[model samples]
Target chain A: MIIALTVLLTVTGFFFFFATTIGLIRFPDFYSRMHAAGKGDTLSSLLMLLGLAIYSLHHFSFGNFLVSLKIIFIMVFIFLASPTATHAIIDAGFESGVKPWTKEEERAEE
Target chain B: MHFIYMFLIMFGFWIVLSGKFDAFHITLGVISCLIVSFLSLDLFFHETKKKGRIAEVVRFLSYIPWLVKEIVLATIHVAFIALRPNVKDNIDPKVIMFKTRLKKDLSKVTFANSITLTPGTITIKVSDDEFYVHALTKKTAEGLPGEMEERVGKVFKEFGE
Candidate 1:
């Protein structure tokens, strides 16, 4: 049962990461690329780590449970840090006065 | 009072993290939780508004499950949009500007973080009275400073609106 759930989580995590890569390559600008990098990257990596944590509990010893708890702690930390990092990068862009990509800019790039 | 409350929570968290109930380790946890809580209890609250702290905590605790539900729904929505071919029409990224009556700094931060955590929207700028949210679609932005604001208002009990 645990193995099945672990596989499902791993696959879902990989799917998000795959989408992040596609979105990164296909998206036209830095900010849009960030949309992929920020949201997809965070969620995918979080889910993957969560899967690993669950897998770590296969034996269910107290030590393994402790290890999984630590993994969850890391997840909580990443949950807080990843979005802050994204916001900081974008805020820096806004401060540097980089104009967001507009429809006209999109056409020009093509 | 908040200092004491903070100390208890910090110690409880420390216990969970350390997972050792030995007297020496427990003593260390108590000491650390006291030092950290004393140093940073202010960080948690901009205004500890004299209302009953227990009630406030209860309200805030109830808000978490609802927020998690929203996060899941928003994630699925974004996933669907991202998976669709030719996302140009689907993703109408734009900055939405809006004003709100939420007064406390903590509530505002909660609102902003809540916005960013949900898919399809990220808070670009936050002024005392207004927000500049960068959203991935028109539908996503349409409810800004609306339903979300109301939910946060409930959480914070922002009655002065």
Candidate 2:
């Protein structure tokens, strides 16, 4: 049962992940694209990790618990690091003077 | 009292790494923990008040999920911006200075770090109640001091501010 739940969550997470990836491709402006990617990646990783933790509990052993703890640790680290990385990238773009998308502006740029 | 807590943490880590409960290993764990803890006494001394430190640590731990959610949202935002071929070209980067009401050093730092962690903002500098942030877009610049201030304020409360 736990395995099934895990698979379901992982699948759902991947769906969002790829959707954001596509949004990065299709969105007409930087800000809108960022809106999709930032929210999508965070949710997907979190859901996937929670699913793995749930699956780990079914085995209920010392080693398995420790492994699960390690996974949690990684998730926590990513939780901290991912935002910092994103901010850095955005800062770089801003420093370079990139302009945001607008309706009329988008039509002209394309 | 302080040594006891350090000993427990180190011993737990030792057991986790060594996967042994033998007498010799246990003895080695004690010695190693003592050595490390003794060397780290400066940290304990700096945090002289013990009554609230543990609670503060617990509070910070609980805040991790919220922090993670924020990060994930920010990442998705940036990736979408970066990958859009046509949209990627129009980024208007500008710096804005704002006044913050947060007083404590730690809270101010947390506020700055959190702002810089989000996709479109970078904390350029912070001084007491003032912060200079560089935003990738006007929207992000406008959102500054809204939700970010509230979260950082809560973190300050954790530290007994």
Candidate 3:
């Protein structure tokens, strides 16, 4: 059960990660790509971590549970931190005057 | 006191990991914990704050689970939106203003970070009476100073002032 679930999660995580990478490369603008990087990528990674946590419980002991809890704890920390980092990047971009793409900007010479 | 506290905490953690109460492992745990904590004293030596102490550590631990749930929910929401067929048509970006009641900087930053972690919100700038948030959806924008502010305010004891 653990092995199957781990494989499932690994596959789904890779799918989302590939989507994120593709979205970054193919999106029309920075803001759109930022949306991709900031939103789904974090969740993709967490899903992968969750599967790992469940697999870790196969050991079926207090110590394994603690290790699982520690992973969850780190997930919580990353949950708090990643978006803040994304916001910081956006804030920096805006401060440096990166404007959002208007329809006109989208059409000009593309 | 420091040595004892360190020994107790780390040894407890070691026992949790080793699943053993045997004397040999217990002694090893104590020694390891003491060494790490003693070295970590170098970190504490430069600190000057009095308000932040053991109580804050306890508070933060209590705060973790709720934050994780919020992150998961936010992540799901963002993923759904991103995968939608007509996502950009739904985008309604704007800046908003709201008041926060939290007194401490750390708690204030936590609140802001939570907003940022959510699907469509980013805290662009913050001041005492106003927080300027850049939101990607009108609905999200409308909920500024939403329940989150209240919850975070409660954590910082910023209620009803």
Best by the DockQ measure: 1
True contacts kept of each: 0.15, 0.20, 0.24
TM-score of decoy 2: 0.67
Predicted candidate 2 versus true structure: per-residue lDDT over A57-85, tens digit per residue: 89799888877777787777775665556
How many steric overlaps does candidate 2 have?
Answer: 18
TM-score of chain A of each: 0.90, 0.83, 0.88
In order, what lDDT does every prediction score? 0.78, 0.70, 0.71
Candidate 3, B128: how far from true, in Å? Answer: 5.0
State the lDDT of candidate 3 residue by residue for B1-161, as single tens digits: 65566667766767766767889987887778788888876564354557746665676677767766875665555555556666556465566677777777777888877777666677766677567677666778887777877777766656654
lDDT tens digits, residues A1-110, model 1?
89888999989989888877877776655666667777777778778989999999999899899889888988889877877887888778877887776565577888
Ranking, DockQ, top scorer first: 1, 3, 2
Cα deviation at A20, candidate 3, in Å, is 3.8
Better of 1 and 2 by TM-score: 1
Extract clashing residue pairs from model 3.
none
Candidate 1 structure quality by residue, lDDT tens digits, B1-161:
77887888898788778888899999999888888987897788657478567877898889888776765665566566667788775676777788878898878988887887776788777878888887777777787767777878887788753
Every candidate's chain B TM-score? 0.78, 0.81, 0.64
